[model samples]
Target chain A: MDLDFTPGEDTFRAEARAWLAAHVPATALPSLETAEGFAAHRDWERELSGARWSVVSWPEEYGGRGASILRWLVFEEEYYAANAPGRVSQNGINLLAPTLFEHGTDEQRARILPAMASGATIWAQAWSEPEAGSDLASLRSTATRADGGWLLNGQKTWSSRAAFADRAFGLFRSDPAADRPHRGLTYLMFALDAPGVTVRPIGRLDGKPAFAELFLDDVFVPDEDIIGAPGQGWRVAMSTAGNERGLTLRSPGRFLAAADRLTALWRERADPHDTALRDRVADAVIGARAYRLFTFTNASRLAEGGDIGAESSLNKVFWSELDIRLHETALDLLGSDGELADGDDGGGWAEGYVFSLAGPIYAGTNEIQRDIIAERLLGLPKGRR
Target chain B: MRFLLDAEQTAFVRTLDQLLAAADTPAVVRAWSAGDHGPGRALWERLAGTGVFALAVPEEYDGLGPLPVELAAAFVELGRHAVPGPLAETIAVCALLRGLGDRGPAKEWLPRIASGEVLVTLAPAGSYALDADAADAVFHVVADGLALATGHGPVRASLDPARRLARPTGGEPLMSGPAVRDAVREAADWASFATAAQSLGTGLALVEQTVAYVKQRTQFGTAIGGFQAVKHQLANALLGLEFARPLLYGAAVALAGGSPGAGRDIAAAKVACGEAAYAAARTALQLHGAIGYTAEYDLSLWIGKATALRTAWGTPAECRARVLAG
Candidate 1:
C-alpha cells in the first residue's frame, strides 16, 4: 500500500540518474534492426556492461549488483527518462537469461551470461515458423542425435534480430512421435554463423529488416547448449514466454518515457482547437502511468515471493496496446508531418509508429494473449487453441 | 515501495465485503430506487457498525481516519454490492470539513456522520444534491468555497433512479479564502478518488457477473464462453479492470503521503478507472445480449451505478483536463 521509495532506493535512483546522464549518447543511435545501428547499440551495451548497469538485478558473480526488482524498476525509470539507448542485448538479457537462470547449467551461466551481458554476443528468438505463428507447439523444427552434439534442421520465420544476432535459441522436436504436440521438444541454442545456418532478413512495412527468417540444415548444437531436460522444452519455453510477455520485455519505464515525449510533442505541435486529440494525449499519459503503477504492484508481489503467471497475458495485452496508443497520439499531434521519417528529433516518430504496429503481433499476438487471460486468469471455458 | 494493501487495509476490505455480502444489497437497492429508503438506511447503519463512514472523518473527531486507502477499499466493496446512496459524497464532505481545519462545523457534523446518525450530501454550485430528500444536511459547493446550504427543491430523477438529485439553494457561506480554495479542491479530489474506486468495483462486478453468465447461458450447442470472440471481449474488459486497480491504489497512496501532486494522481485514476469501468459495462451489456437489458436483472443495478460514478466526481473530459494541466 505504500508508494514511498526507501532512502537507499532514492540514493540508487540518484546514482542511476547521474550515470545515465553522463554516459548516454548525445544523439540517438540508428534503429537496432539496421546494420550500423546494430553495431552502435552493441557498443552501447558494452559500455553499460562495463559499468555493471546492463543487468543490475543479476547476482554479482554474474556481473550484476543483485539489486532487488524495486531497484531494477528505479534503474529502468532512470534509464528511460535519460533517453538512453534501446537495449540491443534484450533477447539475451530479458528473454533468454531468465530461462537460463532457471534452467541453464552453472557452466552455461558462467560461459554464456557474461558474453550476453557485455553484448559480445547478441541473441535472437527463433520460436515461430511460417506455419506455426500462434500455434507454436505445432512447429516442425527438429533436432536429432549426432556424434558429439545435436544436429538441427528446420526453418524458423519471424526471428527477431536474427539478421544481425550472433546466436539464436528455439525449441526443436527431439522426439517427434511423442503423444502431444508440445511434448518431446528440446530447447537449444545455436550459433547463427554455423556452417549449415542461413539468415534471410525480411523487410518490415517501413522497408527495414526488423526481423529475419532462419534456415538451419544440420547446424550442430552441443549437448551442453540445451536448456532444461529433454522433452521438457514446453515447460522451459513457457517460462521464457512468461518473461517475454511480462515485466522484462517491455518495462513500464519505456512507455512512461514515450508518454512524456508524446506530451511534449502535443505541447509543441498540436492544434489549439483539437480537444479530441488533447483528451487522447491525456489518456496516453494516464495509460502509461497506470501500466507503471501496475508493474510496481506486480514487482512488489514478486519481491514477496509471488509468481506472475497467466496475469502476464494481461500485461502483454495492456502494454503492447498502450505502446501503440501512445505512439499514435504522438503521430496525431504531429498531424501531416507524422509521415516524415525523422519528425521528432532522431527518435523517429514515424518509424516508431510503424514499429508499434508490430506490438500486437509479436511476443505472441494480442489475440493469443487474450485467450490466455480468458481461460487461465478469468476461468473462461477453454476455446479452440 | 510496496504497492499491495497492508494487512489492516486487507482486513477492512474483507470485513466490508462480508458485511455487504450478507446485507441483501439488491433488495436495498431496489427499495431505494423505488423511493423507499428504509432498507437502504438500515444497511448504511450496519455498514457504519463496521466503522465504514468513520474512515473518512479525522481521528480528532471520534472517527478513525482521513485514511484514504482504507476508505477507498471500503467504497470498492460498497460499489461491488451496488450500494445505493451518496457514498462518495459523504466521504468527500468529511474531507471538506477536515480541510476546513479545527472548526465548529466539523466538530458538530463529523461525529454524527461517523456514527451514521446523519446522512449528509453536497452539491456543486449549479449541480444537485444527491439523495436530497434523505439528506439531513446539504453542503453547497462553489468554485472555490463551500457553505451549509438549505432549501432543497423537490427530488429530480436521474438516469439512476436511486440517485435522486435536487438543487439545494439559500447558501450560508461557512468557508471562503485561499485555504478554502485548496480545501474545496481537496474535496473534489477525494470525491473523484472514491468514485473512481467505486467505478472500478462496479466494473469488477459487471465483468464477474458476465463471466458467470457466459459460462452458463449456452447457445449453438456449447457454452458461449467457448467462443473466441466472447472470450476476447471479456479478456479485454478484464485487462482494463486489472490495470486500473493499481492506479486507484496508487492514488490512495499519494493521498496518504500528502504528496502535492495527489490531485493529479487522483484525476488520472479517475479517468482511467472510470473509463475502464464504463467500458466493462458496455462489454457486459453487449455480451449478455438481451437479458442484460432488463432492469429486473441484478446486473442492471451495477450497470447504472457505473455510469453514475463515472461523472459523479469528475467526467472523463474534466479529469483528463486536470491530468494534462499538471
Candidate 2:
C-alpha cells in the first residue's frame, strides 16, 4: 500500500499551501485563558468561512468543495501548516453538521447547514447531566410534551462552549415509561436565547470559561427542532460520537503539525549533551509520524468507501495519548520555563501543557473509550453495570 | 496507506498459522524446552521452500527483493504458534550481508536459509551477547581484533535455553571502518523493525491465549474472565498489541520508503513492541493462574522467549534513549 499522495494530490497540496500562504494572515487566536480572548477568537472562524476554507470535508452544498477524504486530510495538513487560527465554531461545523447530515430532516438541514457552514451560528452540546458523566445514558434531563412541541427542563453541566453558543443539541428523556432508559431518550435542539434558559460560565482550573453549566427551565423547542424520530436520541448521539472520531477531533496531520512545532521548539534550545530531552523530542516526532500513517490508512479506506468499525477507537486513544505526551514533553524540555503561563513573561509551554490536560477528559474520556475497546473490539465479558 | 495483506500473503499466513498450530502445541513446546529444536525443523524447511526467509533479500543474492511487510506478517504467524527458531535473525543477517556490498555471504547463505538447510543466527555484539556455544562461525565487531567460535561451548544465560549464549574468541574480520559502521547501523535498524514485528505477533498471541483460558477456566463458581479485574488485564494486553502493531508497520513503511525519520521510527517501534510483548506475556502468565507457570505448559516458554528477545537487540530503555537522542 502506497502512503505517498499521487502526483495530482501532491500538486493540489502545493497549490493549497501557496493559497494559504498568500491569503491567510497569521493571527494567534486567544488562548483558552480568558473569556474575552475566546470571544475575540470567534472572528477568526468567520474569516476562515468567508474564504471557503472552514471545514473542507463537508459537501459543496454545505460550503465545502466536496473533496475526497484524502484531499480533506491534505487540507488539514495545510491548514495546520499555515498555523491558522483555531475555529471558534468548531462544535457547529464538526459536530452538528455531521449529525444533521445523517439524522436531520431536509428542512432542518436547509436551515442549519448554511449558517453552520458560514460561521453565522455557533453550537454547543448539551449531553451530560449532573448525575451522568461517563454513564451518559443515565442522564436525568427531562422534556415534557407541550402545546406544539416539547418543553425542556433540566441541567447540563460541563457543556463545552455553551456560554456563547447560539443553539444547543441536547439529549432529553422524552418517554419516562419506556422499557429502556436509552430507548426513552430523544435528541432536541433549542436556541440558547429561548425564554427560561440560563447559561452560567464554569471556570476551569486553568481559569478559562470554555465550558458552562446550562439550566433549562421550561425552554420550548419546536417539534421541527427534534433531530430525528422520537426515542432515537441514543442513535443520533452515536452518529455524533462517530463524527467526533472522524472529523471533530484532531486529524492526524494536525498531530504531525504539532510535532513539528514541538521539535522545532526543542531543537532551538536543546543542549547536545542533554540526551534525555533529545530522546523525548525524537519520540514525539516518531509518534506523530506513526499517527499520520494510521490516519492516512483510515482516510484511504474511507476513500474506497470502506466501513471503519471499532478501529477508530484505537486512533482516538493513540492521538489523545500522544497529544498529552508531546505537550508534557514540551513542558519538561522547558524546565522551569514550562510552568510559566501564557502572559507570565515566559514561553507558552506551560499554557500548552495545561491545555493538553483536557485531551483525555474531552470527547468521551479515554476511560470510556477503553471500555468500548474492551467490550466491542476484544469481545471481553461485559463489566458489571 | 493500505493496511491489508495481499491475497497471496494472506493465504500464506493462513497456511503458516495452521502448520504452527498443529506442530507447536504445548506438548511440543515442553519437549523443545528440554532442548530439542528439531521438531519444528521440517515445518521450517517447508516455510523456507515457500521463500519466507528470502523475502527481504535481493534477487541478485538468490532471494526476493525487500518485502518488509511480508516478512513482518510471516513473523506474526511464527509468534502465533510460538515457533522457536532464529527466523528473525536469519532474515536480519541476510539483509545485513546484502547491505555490506558483499553478495558472497548472502549468496552462500540465501539458498540454504530458504531451504532451511543451514540455520544462520545473528551475532551482532553489544545488542545480544553472541553465544559461541551454538555457532558454526560467529560474526562480531571487536576493537582491533576479530573473533569466531567453531564449536559448542559453555555460556551463562537466564532464559530461552534452546538458543545458547557463549563468548567467541578470535576470527577474521568481515567488514569494518566508517562505511561498514553506517551499513551496520542501517542493518540494526532493520533488525529492530523485525524484532518489533515478532514482538507484536507474540503479544497478540498471548492476549488470545489468556482470553480463551480465562473464559473457560472457572473460579468461584463462574468463569474468572467474568471478573472485571481479569477483563481489564486482558483489555490492557489488547491495547498494548493494538498500539504496537501500527508503530511496527509505520517503521517498516518508513524504512522501505527510505524516509528521513526511519531510524527514529524503528527505535520507537522497537521500544513500544518490546514493552507491549513483555506486558502481554506477564499478564497472560498471571491470568493463566499457575498453569502458565508450570514447565509443562507452553506459556512459560513463550514468556521466557519474549523476555529474552526484548532484551536481545536492545532494552526498551536503550531504544527509547536512541529515539530521543535523535
Candidate 3:
C-alpha cells in the first residue's frame, strides 16, 4: 500500500509547519494544574481558536477547517513537532465535543460548541465516583425529574480538570426503577458553579490539583442539557469513551515528539553507547514509529469511511505503556538529576515520570482494556465477574 | 497514505494460507523432524509451483520480479505453518544473486533457484548458516562481500530440530566490491524483514492454537479461558502480535518504497516481531501447561520455531541497536 502523502496533504503539512513555526511559544507554559498555568494554557487555546487551529477535524461550521483525518494527522505531527503546549481544552474538544456532535440537538450544539472551541468554557469529565472507578456501571449517581428539568445528586471523584473547569458532563441514572445496571441512565451537562455544586480539588501524584472531587446536591439542570435520549446514557457515554481511547484524545504525535526529545537526550549524554540504555532508547523510538504507522493506518481506514472500532483499546494500551518506557529511559539517562523534580539544569523528568505512572490507570485501566480485547476482539469467553 | 495490503496482496496471503492449510503442515513438520525431508521437499515444490520461491528472483531469470512485499507475504504463511526449511534465507539469496549484476555465478545460480532445482541458504557474517546441510549452495556473508561455500561442513542440532544449522567450509569468494557490499546489506535487511514476518505468523499460530485449547480444556469444573487471569494473559499476547503485525507490513512498504529510514524501520520490525512472538510463545506454553512442554505435541513445533526465530537474523538486542544506531 502507498505510504506517500498526496500533494494536497503535503501542502497542508507545509501550511501547518509554517504556522506552528511562527506561533509556538518561545518558553514552555507552566504546569496546567496550577492556576497561573491553567490561565496561560487557556489563553493559548483562545489563540489557537483565533487562528482556527483549535480543531482541524471539525466541520467548518463548528469552527474547524474540515480537514480529513490524514490532514488532521499531518496537523498533529506539526503541532507536536513544534513542542507546543498540551491542549488544556482536551476534555471539551476531544472527548465531549465528539459526543455533542454525534448526540446533541441542534440547539445544544449551537449553544455550546462555539464557546467550547473558543476556550470560553473549559469542560471536565465526571465519569468515576469513589466507588465506581473501573466499574462505571455501578455508579449510584441519580437524576430525579424536577420542574422542567432534572436535579442531579452525586459525588464524582477523580474528575480530571474539574478543579478549574467551568462545566462538567457525565452519566446519571434517570429512571431509578430500571433493573439492568446500565438501563435508564441519562447523560447531562451542567455548570460546575451551580447553586448546590461544590468542587474540592484532589491533589495528584505530583501534588497538583489537576483533578477534583465534584459533589452535587440536587443541582438543577435544564432539560436542554440532556445529551441523547434519557435512559440511553450508557450508549452515549460509550461514544465519549471511544473518543478518549482513539486517535483524537491521544495522538501519535505526542509520543513521536517525546521520542525525538528522548533520542536527543540520549545522543547528548556522556555515554551515548550504554548498551542497556541504548536498547531501551531504540525500543522507545521503534514503539513510537510503530504507533505513528498504526495511527496512519487508522486514519486511512477512516478516510475510506470505516468506523472506529475496538482497536482503540489496543492503541490506548500501547501508547500508555510507551509513554512510561520513553520517560523511564529518559530518566535513566538523566542519572542523578532524574531523582530531582527540579534540578539546577532545569530538568523535570521526575515530574513527568510521576505523571506517566497514571497513563495505564486513566481513560480506562489497562486491565479493563485487556478484558475488552479478549472478550471482543479475540472472541474469547467472557471472564466471570 | 495507505499502510494496509491492497486487494491483490490480501488475496495472495489468503491463497498462501489455503495452500499451507491443505499441505497438512503439522504432518510435514513432524516428518521433517524425524530426519525425513521428503514431505518438506514436496511442500516446497508445491510452494515453488505457486511461484513462492520465484517472488524475489529477477524477471530476466525466468521468475517474478524482485518484490520484497510479495516475499514477505509468502514467508508469513510459510512461517504460520512452521515450515521446516530456510525459506527466508533462500529468498534472500535469490535477491542477492539478482543484485550481483550479470556475474557468472549469478547467471548460473539464478535459473536453478527460480526453477526450484537447487536450494540456497545464507549465514550472516556472525550467524550460523541455516539449512546449509540441505542446501545446494551456501552463501557465507561477510562485511565486504559474500563467500560461497562449495561444501557444507558438520551440521549442528538446534533447539528446533526442523531447523538445522551447519558450518560452511571451503568458502570461494563469489562477489566483492561496493555494489556487492550494498547488495549484501540489502539482503540482510530482507532477511531480517522476512524473519520478522515469520515470527508474526508463528505468533499468530500460537495464539490461535492456545485460544482453541483454552476453550476446550476444562479446569476446576470450568474452562480456564473463563478465568480473568487466563483471559488477561492471552489478551496481552494478542495485543503484542496485533501491534507488531502493522510494523512488519510498514517495514515491508518502507523497504519496497526505498524510504531513507528503511534500515531502522526493518530493524524496528525485527525487534517488535521477535518480542511479540516470544511473548506469545511464553503465554501459550504457560497456558498449555504440561502439554506445551512435550516434544511429541504439535505445539512444540511452533513454540520451538518461535524461540529459534527470535534470534535468527538478529537477536532482539542486536536489532534494537541497529534501530538506535540509525
What's each prediction's clash count?
1, 7, 0
The two-chain DockQ for each candidate, comma-separated, is: 0.87, 0.46, 0.79
- Ten consecutive residues with minimal summed lDDT in candidate 1 chain A? A338-347
Q: In candidate 2, which residue pairs clash? A: A2-B1, A278-B324, A279-B324, B131-B166, B132-B166, B146-B171, B147-B171
How many Å off is the CA of A143 in candidate 1? 0.3
Of candidate 1 chain B, the 10-residue stretch with the lowest lDDT total is: B141-150
Question: Quick one: best lDDT, which candidate?
Answer: 1
TM-score: model 2 vs. ground truth: 0.93
lDDT of 3 by residue, B162-247 (tens): 88887777776767788887778788778888899899999999999998999899989998888889888988898888888778
Identify the runs in model 3 with alpha carbons over 4 angstroms from their true place.
A343-346, B142-144
- Provide the lDDT at B217 for model 3: 92
lDDT of 3 by residue, A1-385 (tens): 7688989989999988898899999888888888988999999999998989899888888789999888888899899989898888999998899999999999988889888888999999999998898999889999999999999998998999999989999999899889998899999999999999999999998789989999999999999999999899999999989989988888888889889888888888839557888888888898888898888788888878887778999989999999999898888898877777753353556767787899999999999998888878877888675
Would you estimate the TM-scores of all the predictions?
0.98, 0.93, 0.97
Q: What's the true lDDT of residue B219 in model 2? A: 77
Candidate 2: residue A178 Cα off by (Å): 0.7
In angstroms, the error of model 1 at A77 is: 0.9
Task: State the iRMSD of every prediction, in order shown.
Answer: 0.9, 2.6, 1.2
User: What tier of docking accuracy does candidate 1 attain?
Assistant: high
Worst 10 residues of 2 chain B by lDDT: B144-153
